[model samples]
Every structure is written in C-alpha cells, then in structure tokens.
Target chain A: MNPRDEILNRLQQVQRDETLPPPWQSRRDFPELAARFRQALTAVKGEVHQVDSLAAAYDLTNQLLRQMAAEKVVVNDERPLPNLPRLPHITYHQVGQEDETLRAFCASADAGLTSADAALAETGTVILTSGPGKSRLASLLPPVHIALVPITALTTDLFTWAASFNRQLPANLNFISGPSKTADIEQTMAVGVHGPKRFIVILYA
Target chain B: MSNPSSATMSQFRHSATVAIADIQLQGALTGATNKFVNGRITALTELPHANALRDHFKKIRSATLANLAHYLELFEERATTAGSQIHWAQTGQDAVDIVLNIARQHGVKLVTKSKSMVTEEIHLNAALEANGITPVETDLGEWIIQLAGEPPSHIIGPAIHKTRHQVAELFSKEVGRPLPADDIDGLTAEARRLLRTQFLAAGLGISGGNLAIAETGTLVLVTNEGNGRLVTSAPPVHIAIIGIEKICPDWDAAATWLALLARSATGQPMSIYTTAITGPRRANDPDGPEEVHIILLDNGRSQLAGTPYEEILQCIRCGACLNVCPVYKKAGGHAYGSPYSGPIGAVVTPLLFGLEEYAALPQASTLCGACKDACPARIDLPRMLLQLRQDEVAARLLPWRERKAEEFAAFVLGREGRMNFFTKLGRWGQRPFQHDDGLKLPVNVGDGRTLPSLAPKPFRQLWDEGAVE
Candidate 1:
C-alpha cells in the first residue's frame, strides 16, 4: 500500500480501538509568528557574524568542491588562504553540471573557490541545505572545507534571526561551525579528526 | 521479569571511573563544549535583549510545569479530537508493552526509528528484535552505532568517537564493497541509500518527543535530518515514547524551550525541521501519520518530583552539560553505563535505580561545578552531587577507607588542646622533610608530600626567637 493509505488504515484502526484521542484543530497566528521568528534570526545571526566572520560565510557545497580541486589549494573571489604557517587546501565544484558519479574530487586546479548566497551570523555557522545538483555529502565528506558567504545571513542571536528560512527546506540542512574536531584522545584538543582538518570562510560585502 | 537496575549500577561504577581517565573522551568533549559555549557567547552578544528573552522563557516554563497536569489533560483531549491515540505508561515496562502490542497487532516485521534517547534508556530496540520486529535506526549517528552494535556515547553526536576511516570501514562492510579510504561522499551515499529503504519499507515509525504540549496534545520533534519529518509522516504507525516530565503546559511554553534548546545544543537559532504533530493525519492533510500513539513513560521521574533532585526534571536533555564536563571528557558516555551519562547521568541513574546500585557514582565528581554552570535550567548539579554523598554517608555506604580517614580528621579537629600541640609539633618536626623551595613532595608516601610541610619553627618559637612580635 502507499504511505498515505497505510497511514489512513492505521488511523482507522486506532479510531475503532478507542486508543486515539478526539480530533482537535490548531489555531496559530501565522503572520505574527513568522514575523517574530524572522526578527529573532536576523538579530542572532548578525551577532554571530561579528564573532567569527569567516565561519559565518562558509557554504558547505562550494567548500567541499573547492577542497576537491587538484592543487590542494583553492582561492575564490574572497581571497587566498593566509600564508603561514598553516594553510589548508581549498577546491571547487560545479553547480548542477558536474556528474554526480564522481565519488570524490581532488583539486585539478591550483586553487578553487565557490561563494555563498547568504551567511548566518549566529554561532559563526555556515548553513548548507541540499537540493537538485546540491549534494548533501559535499557539505560533509570533505577534509578541508571553505565557504564564501554573503554578508546578509548574519544575525546576533539565533532566535532573533531564524524566521528567514521559511522557504521550503532541503532534505538535509547542515549547520557547520569551525573544523571537525575531537578531544576524545586523552582530553587533548585535536582538530580535523573526522569532518574537516580546517574550515575557512570568505565573507564579501 | 528481571530487574537490570542492579547490574546497570555496577556497570555505571566501572564505566564512570574509566571515563574520568580516558583522554580521547576528554578531547572530544572539550572540543564540542568550547565550540558551543563560545558560539553561544557570540550569539548572545548580538542579542543584547537576550536576558529579557531568557527571563520570558523562564517564566513561561515555570508556569507550564506548575500546571503540567492541566496542560496534559487538555493536550490529551485535543489530540484525541485530532484523531490521535495517547497512552500513558507508568513505567518503562509498560511503555515497551504498549509499543509491542501495537506492532504485534499489525504483524509488523520492520520498524524505523529516529534518534530517541528514551527508547535507548528503555532498551526498546532489543525488545522489538526479541519479538522478531527488525527496528532500524535512521539517524546517521545512531545508524553507525547500530552497525557497530553499541549504544550512543554522546547525545548530539552519537558517532563522535568514530573517525571517518572507521565509518568508511563499517559502511563498506555493510554495503559489501571495498569503498575508498578517504571517500566521504561514498560513505554518506551508502548510508542514505540504506536508510531510505528502511524508511520506505518500515511498518512502524517510533520517535521521541522534544516537547509535548499538554493543552494541545501536540508532540514536537526538532531534527536536522528530514528523517524525523519522514518517520512521523511517512510511516503508517507513529509511536512517540516520551518521559512524563516532557509535558509542557502549552504551545507558548514549548516555543520558549525550543528557542533555547536548538541554539544551546547545536547553535542553531532554529532546527531545520520543527514539526508540531497534534494528531493522526487529518482528512484534508495530504501528509502525516494515520495512527499516532504517545506513550508517556514515567519510569522513575515521578519519584523525584518535589525532591531535592526534582529540579533535574526541568532539564531539556540538550546534553550541553555532558559536552562541557571535564570528567565526561575523559570518560565516554558508555563509562556512565546508563542511558543518561555524565553529570546529569551521575545523579539521575542512581536516583532512578536506587543508591545501593550506583554508590560509586556519587563520589565520581571533582565537584568543580562546571556541569551546574553549563546547565540552562540551573539544575544545581554540584549541590545535588554533594547531597548524594551525604546520603551515602548516612547509609554507611561510604567506603571503609574514606570513613576511617574522615573519622581521624574529625577526631583531631574535635580537640583544641591536642590540635594545638599537634600544630606546634607539625611545624617543628617537619623541618627535615621541608624542601628549600618550600614545595611539598609530589608522591603520596612519607618521602613524598605525605603531610603539609610546616615552618621550621612554631608560632611561639618564632616569638621566642624574636622573628615575630
């Protein structure tokens, strides 16, 4: 049976057995709720941007693609990785065009870069939701992920700024903060153990 | 039926100690906690009015919890009105029975579950498997652990202990392929494919409620994975296993808690999916479950109400305390041996199971008050821990060595005359053992810093020697 039919049958069974509750309706002030939610998210993300500008700008999709580039270093419109001492490579991936067949992409080019449409300022986290040609794995599986973020998605407090994302959500939404790290080994802080060794974000005006 | 409470307590003792010493556990904990704490601080800086918002949430929560019964009644009424079934389980066994009976009646062969710590605590998966129903874990973290045949160590990041290499290996075996070593995409795709099949074919979907509004009988689940939304809406049978204390009086109270929970646990202002399910699918509603069952499991929570530890119920199970605890860092969640691990686990496991079963957990703390500081609801963890210690002492459950040491210290301090003599001798006699730098010996033996190094001369001797007035 289809999912709907299965659910209907189950509901009917519950009804017959007297196990289900009496039906009730929800009354919500949608407009007011939406407005307040938006206001809160805006404020929160704005503040988060101030604390970690680069992290707030990361777009997981582009970050993953850039890291996969050939040269082990990708420089987008945002700028090149800082010299020093410790510079992780960045690569780029194409949107909607690339074959989803490639299991992994290593940088063929010296440096690749992809920019983000918006950044969430709260917690300096980058938001990456999945869609057509936007592989959710790209946001996660890469070793060093970098995102170029637009300044708009920044908010100070999370609750203040969350309302803007009311648009239909992707099947998966990943909120990434900093590089994947763990202190699991003897309480010593070690970064890039699993997800990413380094995470860089490039924010633009 | 056998009570595993006793066995659980012993396991808790062994694991908690190991957790205290495990360095890798510490690193994982510290990394997540610092990120969260720092992230929250940054987030708060943007909301200068956050204190006011917090106060509003606190007030709302207090009011909701105060009239929890009323809200729960209303919720039941409304949810039934919306064509949903609600069942109350006074204990864990009852909850398990309710879910099993439903599955049996339907002749369910397979069930898909989202991440619900409540199910873990009650060992629901095992129960289903014993009854020949294959229960699959749909959460990424949960799925990995299920493949490894272990319980979750961390609440938020269940597979936090696992390396990508480890995950790839596990997934590769499951998929029967020689997957690439550094292939993150391959692993994720493999998991997604596997879970989708489970999702589509499952006869039952069981989940845990983040919040249950009593007045509306609405159950809310906040998840990042579309799995949660799917688990409840796609499956024919949806059963929610929630603790009795999870009930909030109204939608306003739920909103207040949700506002803080996602942000606190994941730094998300709002989770990707915030589903408020009131009842079974409506006639007009295109999607949602047809049958919805909420099993309210009291377990051991009601016994704690109005007790000193009752404040623990206010905990939203955000796992923030575990993420930040220094001890939990060393000891992974398994070390706690109970479903609830870390500082909160330390207190709750024993209280729920009884003191004799978990005597060692009370002494597990360094009493640094970090857990208490990190708690969103201000569950005075250290105070509760100390109280447990006191109770242990009253019950004469204190280890003999500690009891003897305490008695000796008390006796010495009880007498002023002997104390004065001892104090005088303590200064003069310890001169030979004193180091030039005035540092105590590092070892526990007499050769080491067995006693506090005292001054070469007594206070009176200093006066006699004209070193003091």
Candidate 2:
C-alpha cells in the first residue's frame, strides 16, 4: 500500500470524539490600545512613536533615521512616501526598481521603511505581507526596520488580526513582535543577530 | 553520519550519572530551565484569561489530533493547489530517501537547516552527510553543536550544555583562529557573518514547521533569529518536514496555537518573527523559494492514534515540561538519549521508539506532576508514565530481580496478615543497616541514595494498645 493510504487508514481506525468545544473568543475591547501596544512592544525592545498625524509620523521617521546615522534607506513600494521630506545626502533604494542588485542593496542598507498591513495591540506585533513591489528582504536584511502603522490598523490580538484577512491572503505573512534577538548564548539576550536590530513603529492617528 | 554516542537508550543511565556529576552541565540546565520557567510564569500572568486560552488551545490540539487524517488530507490538497509537492514518509528512512532524491535531482550541494527537532528525530543530517551533502545548521545553538559534532542537549537551546569557553573553542576551530570566549556580542556578530554567506550560497533550505494550517495550506515557523526566514526565503528550493500531528483545523486554531506557543516556551508574547508560508513564491513575488516541498512524516506517530498515549501527539515542542521537570533538571537532556528529552521525551520516546529500548526512560521520572502543570496543552504526562510502567510490567520487560520484588510486595500487600508480618520483619531486618535514622547501604548498592529508616513502632501495634485513639 502507498504510505499515504497506509497512514490515513491507520488514523481512520482511531476513534474520535465528534463533539469539539467552541473556539476561543478573544475580548476585543481595549480602550487603552495605544498604551498597551507600546508597553508590550517596548518590553521586547521595540520602539513605538504615536504621532498625532501622518506629517508627524514622517517627521519622526526622518528624525529617527538621522539619529541612527543611517545613510542608505530601502522603502517598500506598496504605498508611496510622497509627503515625507527627502534628504539630499541620504541614499534611498526605492522598491520595484528593476535593479537585480536589490538584494545586495538591502543587505548593505542601513534601514528598511515599510507600512504594516495590520497590528496586534495585545502582543504589539506588526503584520507584513509579501506581494507585488513588497520585498521580504527589505524588512528582513536591513539592520534597522521602521514600520509606519496607522492607529486604525491596530487590533486586539492575533485572532482579531487574522479575522481581518477573510479575503485573499498573501504568499507570506510575517508577524514580527520586536527586533531580531537571541538568547542562544548562555541565556544572554543579544539583538540583531540576523534581522533588524532596531524595530521602530510610527503609529499615526 | 553515524548516530551520536549518546543516541543509544542503553547509555541513558551512564549519561545521566555523568550529567549529574558534571557541575557545568548542572549549572547550565539550572540557569536555562529557571529562566524559561520564570519567563513563562510572568508571560502567562500578564495575559488576560490565560488559563481559558490554554484550555481552548488544548481543545484545539485534541480536536486536531482526533481528526488528524482529515486535516492532513485537507492540508495536502490546499498545499498542492498552491503549487507545493507533497510527499508521505511512513518511516525515518523513507523520509531521508525522499529528501535525498530531491536533493540529487536538484544537485543540491549545501543544505541549510533551521532548527527542526523532527529532523533530529529522523536523523536527517546524518543521512544527508552519508550521501555527501553538507548540511549546515544555521541556528546559532544548533550551529554550535554541529561544529562540536555533538547531539543537541536541550530542545530549544541545543548547545545549552556547553559554556561560553567551550563554544569559543568550537567556533575558533571553525574560523581557524582564536576568538573571544566571554564576549557574546562579538560571538553573535561572527556567527552572523559566517552564516550569512552560507545562507546565500546554500542550494536548498530544510525547515520544520511549528504548525501547519490546514485551511490555508500554510506552514508557520516561529523564530527569534532570522535564520528561519532566510532558510525559507533565501534558497531556491525549500522543504519542510512536518509530523502528522502538527496540523490545525483552520486559521482560528492556528491563531490559538501561535498565542500559546511562544508565551509558553520563551515567555515572549510572540517571537521576533512568525513567518507563515502559504506556498512557493508566486510570479509577482520578488523573493522566496521557487519550489516548495512538504514531507508529511509519520514515523511511528500513526500507530499512536486511538491509544491512551495519543495525547502525547498534542505536544508543540515548547519545552515547558523540561523547565519544570525535577528529573530533567537533574538528569539533563543528554540523559534521555533521544532527540527529545525530559518528561515529554520519557513518554513519547518509548511510544515512538520501542518500550524495551527506552525502558530506563519511564523510570527516570519522579512522578511529581510538574510536567503536566507546565505543559500548555496540559498533557497528563504523569498518567502516561504510570501507564507505560504498567505496560512494562505486563510485558515482563523488567529484570527478574525487580519482577520478583514486585511480585513479593504484591503478595504481601494483598493480605492484611502478610502485610503486618512483613512490616514486623522489615523493622527487625533493617536494624543492621540503620544509621542516623536512615538506612546506610554500600555506595555500589545504593548509588549514594539512602532509604528512610522504618518507624520505631508500627501504627497498628499502637492502635491495638489504644494509645493512638
């Protein structure tokens, strides 16, 4: 017999209790979502800047980039950052460029800026999906990642965030809670071993 | 390519004895397990309705396992529809062969791995090396152990048994120069530099899925380091080996699992990265594996269905049980002499492997019930241990001396008169061995453990004299 059939047949013989308990219902009401999200994100070494407007968010992004002394920046092409003031000295790698050297550019880039698809307030996680003009490596390879998330995108938790994706899901969905970190060495926490060392979220109203 | 020295179950007692004597191993285990235990407590305390969430997670796991075949078939159908080739392997060798054939067809020279315990259980690395394919472990801890040519000691922290100095030596050999032993940041930087090139160069990436979403045909991987992302995204070809039990019914179930997993394991609300791969990269996608293969491996798991021990399949490999287990704390992961260790290992290893081979494992536990309490799924590991002991007894797998002792004890306890007679005999017979209120046997016989001295007078005797009333 084929291994699949044999295995399925074996599992078929097992008795199953047909009655399953109801799925877990998460409480979605969080009046202090911004505060909660900041607290959770900060605990994992992620910085959250809640701006009153998109203009403030753009200003903060430029301010943060300057503070980190970042020179090369990679921005995802999904949403154009038209309002953000561009610095002449800073080199920018725009997404959707046909340059095959994009991988190397991302590896060498100092920071990656992208817009989050959704945010989980409970865990302070930002969800990113790969699609047309959104390079997974842009968010992954750079040393610093800055996500521009709107306040409306914030949900209670993973369940609520997942529920919003009732339509077509992307090929890949990344739920990133904090900067890349590892305690693999003697239980000592070290950040930025592989992914972005610094994760900055600009939450605009 | 051969199995590690500690792979055999016969070495369990010897390894455990050695592990107890090794102060470094003891300290490492104590530090790591304590951190994890404390973190889990803190994480759960901060969550609202954490206990209810765990209960819901348990229901999801139980329900999924009950209808495992249906979920697996659904996952296969959805995955195939998403342009992924599905392969079924009933045994470890079969899985190894399937992977090797894929590698051969693609002419893959270097394979990057991202910390899959299932791969360790299947001994895939050894098989790959035997076929002349260099399998590089990209996870920092796994890489450390790989360089040292040793089996992983802990589930999450594979090289937790090794100290910084030992790691420095192993890494120095790899780099052909002496590296700083105490500098953790420097070490991580060096590892990142070395593994980055390998990630870019490797032809194929093999990872283990944490949870397979049946509804969407997605494989979820949770990792703090970006190695998981690189392994699944960087390489041209990607293969995920998953056990049959890891399937979740739908997105809701997957959400519940993701909610509990990282919190239970490392006390993080979520890991740094939770990557969900639906399938191979589409035409519009810029980067990801072009080809994706998922190997559904049974390897003794199918036989566990409908059995009393089926709940063991609900394990998410969170390693919480190891943190709380008294036996695992002392004996360490190496002592279990399997890919898995600690309480979960003691039960599952014997069930998946053979009872006679892992006879010593079930006996390793103290039946303290800490494992069950720590488990996110709330698997009754102590109950399973008791059942395994009963199975051993019924199978007559115990030594003749032990069997005789049990039989004699049963015979004595079956009757009140015999019990009283033995109590009197034991009190009198233990006099010669009594010292300082404890029985002091020879070192070779007792192995440094002492039996508590009998009571000065029997309770029954005192009751007969009306003194107890």
Best by lDDT: 2
Model 2, span B1-469: residue lDDT tens:
2233232344677777788889988999999999999999998888788888888888888888888889999999998888889999999999999999999999999999999999999899989999999999999999998998888878888988888899889889889999998999888888998998888899999999999898988889999998999899888899999998999888877888998899899999899899999888888787778899999999999898888989999999999999999989988887777889999999998898888888888888899999999899999999999999899999887877789989998999999999988888999988888998588865444466788888978888789989895
Each model's lDDT: 0.61, 0.88
TM-score of chain A for the candidates in order shown: 0.51, 0.93
Output DockQ, candidate 1.
0.04
TM-score (C-alpha, index-matched) for candidate 2: 0.96
Highest DockQ model number: 2
lDDT of 2 at B377: 94
